[model samples]
Target chain A: MAEAKPIAGTRPLAPKPMSPHLSIYRFQINMILSIMHRVTGITNYFGSLILAIWIASAATSEQAFNTVSSYLATPLGLVILIGFTWSVMHHMLGGIRHFVWDVGWGFSKPAVKFLSWATLFGSLTLTAIIWGYALSHWGIR
Target chain B: MPTTTYRTELKKVRGLGSAIGGPGTDHFWAQRLTAVSNLFVVAFLVYTGLTLAGAPLGEVKAFFGHPFNAIASILVVISTAIHMRLGMQVPVEEYMPHGLKVPFLFLNTFFVIVIAVVGVLSILKLFLGN
Candidate 1:
């Protein structure tokens, strides 16, 4: 069979479809929450590495364990640890939000806005309570 | 009646389903499965963290020496590693340029393996009194 070709100079010249640009849209609560979800997820990657190191130090020797413990006692380490706690909480809540959506619920605008705000406040509240209990009960090493 | 179409019955069906084959639901299902498992395991992890917060090395060792704690610790490590790798791949696939995407994805897998191995081994060493 002979293949047919378009006549010369007769093909359509419509522009290709382009993706929506980020800067063109006004920022909203959901946008911040979504970006935060990604940010905290990446943060948890490093946090997991730190956790591995903490466990490895304990397994190595008491000296090794104390070395990590003392470092964690430092203000900077405490800040990082606190930040990691918050990040984990935030990401976990965000994951739950995603799961809720996956199950085909919470697509309504009000539900979405409520969930986003709830995730933010909920994470902060959990982080505070955890740290508060830890500090009051354990007293930093 | 004369036929007007040239495509074979097979050709018409080809490329109609998931490009990755099977039900094409592997990634979707795996991601959600890990996500669900992670919710439980990670709660255990946080509890472990809280209990061990300022614990000495001996205490820490004793804690994991318990069978349940040791098993839960391993579960947390494995589940988190799988979930993180799957989650991270989304950003790498979406934002990374073609030149860097493949390498990033490979590195993501490699990194997750390292995390899981190191975490589980450490817990085992402590649990075993090594």
Candidate 2:
């Protein structure tokens, strides 16, 4: 087939704009925070599964409940619980950030930075307070 | 001579079509709806976890047996299951290889259903057994 020539008097079409690639951007807090939101979100999937298992074990029988509870009381289990708590807290804050953006707020550069940092520190503080309360009240430590 | 185009204005505004030409809008709203509900449900979950920490089996059962607690537990399971399934679909769609993508998406939905069913049933058993 012969190549079709452009109409002699027609202006050439401009190239379409391409979406920016992730590798092209410099590192920023918001980038990491955005990725962390997805990571923590995925982590919570397993955390919810464990929660289901815990409830199922309790419904099974006293012996089964005791076995699950005892395992949860162990050091490794405590570590897992703490990690889950942190993930939940972090993800919750991230969700709130997304909610704020969804409502057409917090899109400015400074606002984005503030929200990202707040999510990180706020989650840590919340986790610490929760574990502190648990340690003092429940004698977990 | 006037140049002509056949695409609708809405399609033009939407730019690129949705992935796989499916109900992307429904998925978007469903995810946000579940996210909104999960925000509250998760708080109740944390509260339950704190209160039930290291409690004896009888006490634990009694707590779950309470009407409000039982209902709240079921809601938490269902909301989180839906949210996680929708959330996981993003990663699966983006990262999974072409051959594995469809299978993983199906498995993602299947896994969430199993979780939600087992969780709701267990809570119901405890609620009724009380």
Scored by lDDT, the top model is: 1
- Which residue pairs does candidate 2 place in steric collision? none
lDDT digits (tens) for residues A57-84 of candidate 2: 9889888888988888899999999999
Off by over 4 Å in 2: A1-20, B1-16, B19-22
Name the lDDT value of residue A45 in candidate 2: 85
Runs with alpha carbons beyond 4 Å of true place in candidate 1:
A1-16, B1-24
lDDT of each: 0.87, 0.87
Report per-prediction Cα RMSD to one decimal: 6.0, 5.8
Cand 2, B chain, TM: 0.83
Clash pairs, model 1 backbone: none
lDDT tens per residue, model 1, B1-130: 2534444344355846443554437777887898889889988988998899889988999999999999999999988898898889889988998789999999999999998999999999999999
Task: Give the fraction of native contacts in model 2.
Answer: 0.54
Error of 1 at B94 (Å): 1.5
On residues A1-141, what C-alpha lDDT tens digit does candidate 1 reach at each position?
123343465442234445787989897899999999999999998799889989999999999999998899788988999999999999999989999998899999999999999999999999999889877767755
**How many clashing residue pairs, candidate 1?**
0
